[model samples]
Target: MTQAAIPPFHLAFPVHSFAAAREFYGDLLGCPEGRSSADWVDFNFYGHQIVAHLSPDEAGHRATSAVDGDAVPVRHFGVVLSVPQWEALADKLKQADTKFIIEPHIRFKGEVGEQATMFFLDRSGNAVEIKAFANMDSLFAK
Candidate 1:
């Protein structure tokens, strides 16, 4: 069987300011800027299309659920990166003094789905998570 190229996914989320979103996604995270307007901006987020729309009232994460001893934001979206990519991003975040809701650590350690993960909020309080699996096959392990 031939493996097909995965189609890129698109997500639209709220942000209070385009400047802040640009800085966070474009400058800090290294996502390239794409089509943009006064109300919204598109970013090349780890090869996916993510657009930030100006929406003050609906911008921040509002609820959380306890997961493996952390209060994980329920409204978060993220990408699964390689271990090295995860480590580098974690280091960059630390250097930027980014406050983490869930600091970088192994989740589900010594068990199925073991992974390195971190969670933080953007300038508009939108929660974002970045994680990596030591064994990529474990990503959907049962």
Candidate 2:
């Protein structure tokens, strides 16, 4: 769906340092900086709002679950982009030498929910999974 067709989401996550968050999200991922303060910062994450707060005590992925033979992060969040957008972002991340927890590839091949997916952690260890569906309707397929 188009940005105007869906409601934008707000996510509040923890970060160790605002500088790291700014570099990773703002510069690397190309998210635009929004409101911020000494304790937190917000970014326009693909039209959604994501706030990163300085909370060392509550940061990073804590567990994982097996999915299609890979250990998918249990505590992670990210966005669903178009296939072209996902491919472009994947290339950009690779060029930046971004350490991917799960390298970019197609998941669930020939099955429902098939998509292009990649998982990586920010400098502060916040796990993120960016994915794209060839068919957007597959997002919630059963």
Candidate 3:
């Protein structure tokens, strides 16, 4: 589907602390806050719903899958952004000196569905990926 026609999706994930999630997603990631409750908070993550639900005990889990020679988080979450915005965010992350689990760079370069992507861990250890497609049509191209 074309990027503009791609529908947004809702995502709910466990978090160890609401305050920490707030700081990581809201302050650090720059996602705007939305409806919230004591046990859960929502962020408009690139037009997607990312509700961080309180669950301190579930915070310790970590799993990975080898992808493109890197150990990608098996239970991660993230969103696709326009190319320009993605580049801008990459620059911002660089300026902020963000410690990335996978640094911002092109993946599958010169191949179908070529994309720019970066991965980083949140304060609570949740892995997040932010990616972009030079041509939105190439996003799902195969």
Candidate 4:
């Protein structure tokens, strides 16, 4: 028997400004723009649908938790990419002088669930993480 295909997820997040969201999600992250209105915009985030609603009062991180000795934002979202794609993105982000919350590096090295991960905030202060696994099978190990 074969497993069913994964359905695309839809996420709705708040952004302080639509223009900043456009430049971050649409231009920098390369997520194609889908639809837009006076108060919200939609983006194709790595095959997932994400809508950025303009709500300055609801934007930005409010708390964090420590993980692997790093202060990870309590509220964040991202996608799992291939190692090569992650590396290319990391390089591109670095070249753009992106202020990283946690620079791209290997996590859990020499152990189960080893992966490359990075974290940064958008112009509106919403946290975003991008990660890649050396072995996809290890993604669920331990």
All candidates: CA RMSD in angstroms?
1.7, 1.5, 1.5, 1.8
Count of backbone clashes, every candidate in sequence: 0, 0, 0, 0
Q: Write the per-residue lDDT of candidate 1 for residues 1-142, one digit (tens) a residue.
A: 2225667899999999999999999999999999999899999999999999999899999999999999999999999999999999999999999999999999999999999999999989999999999888787888
lDDT of each model, Cα atoms only?
A: 0.94, 0.94, 0.85, 0.92
Backbone clash tally (model 1): 0
Model 3, position 66, has a per-residue lDDT of 88
lDDT of 2 by residue, 1-142 (tens): 3333888899999998899999999999999999998899999999999999999889899899999989999999999999999999999999999999999999999999898999999978999999999888878888
Please provide TM-scores, in order, for all candidate models, with all chains considered together.
0.96, 0.96, 0.91, 0.95
lDDT of 4 by residue, 15-128 (tens): 998889999988898999998899889999999999999999999998999988889999999998889999999999999899999999998888888889999999899999
RMSD of 1: 1.7
Q: Rank the candidates by lDDT, best first.
A: 1, 2, 4, 3
Q: List the residue pairs that clash in candidate 3.
A: none
- The alpha-carbon deviation from the true structure for residue 131 of candidate 1, after best TM-score superposition, in angstroms, is 0.4
lDDT of 4: 0.92
